[model samples]
Target: MGLVRLVVILIIAWLIYSTTRRWLASLDQKWDQKKSGRSEKIETMVSCAYCGLHVPQNEALQAQGKYYCSSEHQKRAESS
Candidate 1:
């Protein structure tokens, strides 16, 4: 009877350990996927021709075949 009880306890412990390990592994994979997905998004970097400041291409102003960080920079570059 004692041996049977020990066997049952060991089986239960193994099942719990296995389940927890799988759950943690899955969670880790999900986190990695999210991080990799974010890293996969590539953005073009541009430098402000006037101030030489770096900015994302999407946020920069386009003028005269050059990129500016703002309208002020654009105006300054155009004037110069």
Candidate 2:
């Protein structure tokens, strides 16, 4: 009877440990996704016409059907 109780206790302990490990792994995965910016909404990326550098569309200056990464690039493009 004592051996059976010990075995049951061991099983319970193993189950608890396994559950905790899985929970921790799930939390780690969520944390990694947040830290890596995977949890954020995807933005459209556009390339600068003058410099050929890629930037997010919302941050880029749009003019004349062209995108520029900065106002300076846009001015340069307009001048040239």
Candidate 3:
């Protein structure tokens, strides 16, 4: 009886370990794919027309075909 109990416990442990390992591996793979996709995205760097500061195109404000680092700069340029 004691041997049977030990066997059952070992089987349960193995099953838990296997499932946990597979789940963690899947999570790792998903994270790696996400990271790779992000790295592959087109990164555009543009200089702010107002201050000549370099910033990522995606975050810069675009107006009149010019990129600005902030809305304040854009408004300042437009007002001037």
Best by lDDT: 3
> What lDDT tens digits, residue by residue, belong to model 2 across residues 1-80?
99999999999999999999999999999999886784243457899999999988778899999999999999999998
Give the residue spans of candidate 1 off by over 4 A: 42-80
Q: Which rank order by lDDT, best down to worst? A: 3, 2, 1
Cα error, candidate 2, residue 20 (Å):
0.5
Candidate 2's C-alpha lDDT? 0.90
Report the C-alpha lDDT of model 1 over 24-71, residue by residue, as the tens digit. 999999999998866654346789999999888778899879999999
Per-residue lDDT, model 1, residue 14, is: 100
lDDT of each: 0.89, 0.90, 0.92
Which 10-residue span in candidate 3 carries the lowest summed lDDT? 36-45
Model number with the top TM-score: 1
User: In model 1, what are the clashing residue pairs, if there are any?
Assistant: none
Candidates 2 and 3, the one with greater lDDT: 3
Superposed Cα deviation of residue 80, candidate 3 (Å): 24
TM-score of 1: 0.55
